[model samples]
Target: MNKKYIQCIGTFSIALPLLAAIILTGITSIVKAHLLGNFAESKNTYKTEQAQIAVLNELKIQHSKKQTQLKQWNQLLTGDSFTKVNERLRQSIADSNKTKTLQLTDAKRSTRPTYAVNAPRSACEFKLEGTFSEMQRCLTKLECRMPNLMINTMSLNSQINSNLLNLKLNYTIWENAQ
Candidate 1:
């Protein structure tokens, strides 16, 4: 065989694999770029959209829970449209005070064995015949131990018959909605 022909055959042998590798690399690059483009678009459009929707759903859930809590607090702070919550609280406290713990001051209202709030709902008024110290302690307990209690008015007068003082106290209590 001629040396020139043999040299040409050797060159073709080396160039064949090199050409194949280049063509295959180009095809793979094109295929990867095509698939990556679609993936990137879906990740930005569909995946992000789904995540945003989920965030909105969570926000709505939390908003509703907060709204419910707000309504309950409102009910506690203000009982109904007609009557004030503090007035009702006062009546309930007065009723509770009317128990045997306190002696009646105004015999007319005290004659009844009931604690009442006159506003078709509640009020706070009670009479206690005792030393000033006892009444003060009771007021402190109401302000501290109880959740929401407001003392509206108090009248302390010395009794002639007894050395102790006569106390006419009025307070309020707030009942919160669950």
Candidate 2:
């Protein structure tokens, strides 16, 4: 080929790979964005609604019904914006009565906890003392009921026949609809 023609062909060959790479990357990004965009339509649209509903469902799973389990679930979920879910928790707790009331303090996270994406949650620190059997029963109750009660610490001290259990129970509730 002539020098000018050869130069044009060389330039096109050199640019071709870069142009192809750019187009491929752009297409990939658009596909990714399209997948993620499916969720961010409006502030309180389908995604938010679904998240809220999931919060309720999780409450149901966590507040699985048992006497003591129900008690804590009710207390945690009550009187908040998540009241509907709390009501569901309350109803679950109403199913049992073997537990006494326990105190829970709203605790600040030293660090923002790792939580599910788009999950608006609040944390509480719960402490309670019970006899060995009672404590086991309580934990069992918690295990049965609470959907999101992350156990930070659990300690048990033996007392006579019944042991004394000092436990720190951490739980979370969704702050917003989700």
Pick the lDDT winner: 1
TM-score of each: 0.34, 0.33
Score residue 31 of candidate 1 by CA lDDT: 97
Every candidate's CA RMSD = 11.0, 18.1
Give the runs in model 1 whose Cα sits over 4 Å from its true position: 1-121
Q: Candidate 2 residues 1-178, lDDT tens each?
A: 6999888787788778789989999999999898678646654597788999999998887666565765765565444533433343344334432454322222333233575576656554445554445545545655455554455444444446544445554545444342
> Weakest 10 consecutive residues, lDDT, candidate 2?
102-111
Candidate 1 lDDT score at position 22: 97
Error of 2 at 94 (Å): 11
Query: What is candidate 1's TM-score against the reference?
Result: 0.34
Best by TM-score: 1
- The 0-to-1 C-alpha lDDT of every candidate, in the order given, reads 0.59, 0.53
